[model samples]
Target chain A: LAKTTQPISMDSYEGQEVNITCSHNNIATNDYITWYQQFPSQGPRFIIQGYKTKVTNEVASLFIPADRKSSTLSLPRVSLSDTAVYYCLVAVNAGGTSYGKLTFGQGTILTVHP
Target chain B: DVKVTQSSRYLVKRTGEKVFLECVQDMDHENMFWYRQDPGLGLRLIYFSYDVKMKEKGDIPEGYSVSREKKERFSLILESASTNQTSMYLCASSSSGTSVRNEQFFGPGTRLTVL
Candidate 1:
């Protein structure tokens, strides 16, 4: 499993765009980058996922450089409701030796202030 | 919308008691998983079932067991509840497909406190 490192917490104002970067220097060739957003007392929700380059969706965008060593999650027009803990994960399969284990880190806590 | 529902939002139990956490998904996904989340530690998988009557132990599965009698439901069982088992339990479901594109849908969660 690839260990990911990200900021413990961040602060952003409403209407601003927030980008949270995750470093996974040991990312494998088959590993896919995924981002999940978790609100207080609620389960985490899938935001976006990408293998390489940039993938944009209605909710957020995922940017993965060529090296695949790092990736960024971009949230547009943040609001107070967007304040949550964002988790960056390297998705792996449950088959084979690794199985389907999603190892989560402390995650980046984004505080959106109005 | 994919919806996963847990039987309880909060539960209180005593030590040395048996406990059961139920999870149901409307999507009829083939795979179901149980995980526990704690502050700073993040989410840890306890058990996962790929099909009915088939299960695999995840990273942390010592004190937990699971059951998958039907395709839409998965249950997590604690043989003897302990205070250390207190945490937010999460149930997730996903369909087996291409590894790169599959995403797991999570339930609201069940906060369990063993006193």
Candidate 2:
């Protein structure tokens, strides 16, 4: 498994875009970058995922550079409710030898204010 | 929606007591996992079962044992609860296949406190 490093905390305000970046220096070719969001007292929810380039969904966008060493999760028009802890993980998908174990680090805490 | 449900939202037990945390997934997923979350350590995998009657130990599985009797259920057993075992327990399930992204769906979590 590729170790992931991200900011310990970030601050944002309403209507602003929040971008969290994760660096995985030893990322493997088959590893994919995935982001998850967790509110207090709740399990983490899947936000978005990408292998390379850019992938956007109804909630967020993931931009992975050509190098694949790092990836960024972009949240558009953030609100106070968007405040939560965001986890970035690099894991091998279904085909690889991994058996669906996710290693979560102390994720970045996004605090959104009014 | 994929639903994963834990037996309890909060539980309190005494030291040396037996503890069992149950999880059930309605999506018929092939993989079920147990994890514990602490203040700063994030989530650490305790155990996971890829199929019924099969199990695998995760990063922190010393004090825990797991059972997968049926396809939809996985159980985490703590033979003797300790204060250090108190934390939020999370259960997740994901389908098995060759898809590129196998996102795990999580339950609400159970907060266990050992006295």
Candidate 3:
């Protein structure tokens, strides 16, 4: 299991691009970087994921360096609704037969102000 | 989209009582998980099941147990409810294939209060 470290909290204004970075020095070779957004009183929702380099989707973009020791989640055009706790996870599965037990750290709370 | 449903949105239980929390997924996923979320602790895994009649303890499994009698249903049980056991219980399911990206789909969550 890899341990991810991220900022405790961050604040951004509307229409701004927010980038949250996570450090996982001990990430395993089979680990994949994943990000999740959790609003108040709700379960965490998958935002984006990446194995290496960069992966972008309609929701957000994931940037993983060649070393794979760190990753960043970029949100384009933030809004008040984007205010939530963002979690960075290094997912490692033993095999297809088992559940990929995700170890979640204290996530970064993003507050988007208008 | 995968849908994971929990039995209750909110629940209240007394100390020394036996409590059961149920979870069901419509996606016929092979893996089901039980997690408890706290303020600073984030989400801690309580138990998980890979297949029917199979279970495994998670990071914080001291006072919690789980059951998976059927493929789509997984249950978490608290033998003796305590105040510390009161928290947000979440159920998640994920397919066995990496084709779905191996991401866990979580339920809305159950807020349990022990008196």
In model 3, the Cα lDDT at residue A3 comes to: 65
Number of clashes in model 1? 3
TM-score of chain B of 1: 0.96
TM-score per prediction, in order, is 0.91, 0.91, 0.91
lDDT of 1 by residue, B58-111 (tens): 889988899999999999999999999999999999897425356888999999
Write the residue-wise lDDT of candidate 2 on A1-114 in tens digits: 456678889999999999999887666566577888999988998889898999999999999999988889999999999999998766533345643335565688999999
By DockQ, highest first, what's the ranking?
Answer: 1, 2, 3
Give candidate 2's error at residue B13 in angstroms. Answer: 0.8
Report the error of model 3 at residue A78, Å.
0.3
Every candidate's lDDT? 0.86, 0.86, 0.85
Best by TM-score: 2
Which segments of candidate 1 are over 4 A away from where they belong? A92-101, B97-100
Model 1 chain B: ten consecutive residues of lowest lDDT: B96-105
Judge the docking of candidate 3 as incorrect, acceptable, medium or high. acceptable
lDDT of 2 by residue, B1-115 (tens): 7799999999999999999999999999998899998866777889988899999888899989999999999999999999999999999998974232678789999999999
State the displacement of the C-alpha of residue A39, model 3, in Å, after optimal TM-score superposition. Answer: 2.1
Each model's interface RMSD (Å)? 2.6, 2.9, 3.4
- By summed lDDT, the worst window of 10 consecutive residues in model 1 chain A runs over A92-101
Q: After superposition, how far is residue A15 of candidate 2 from its true place, in Å?
A: 1.3
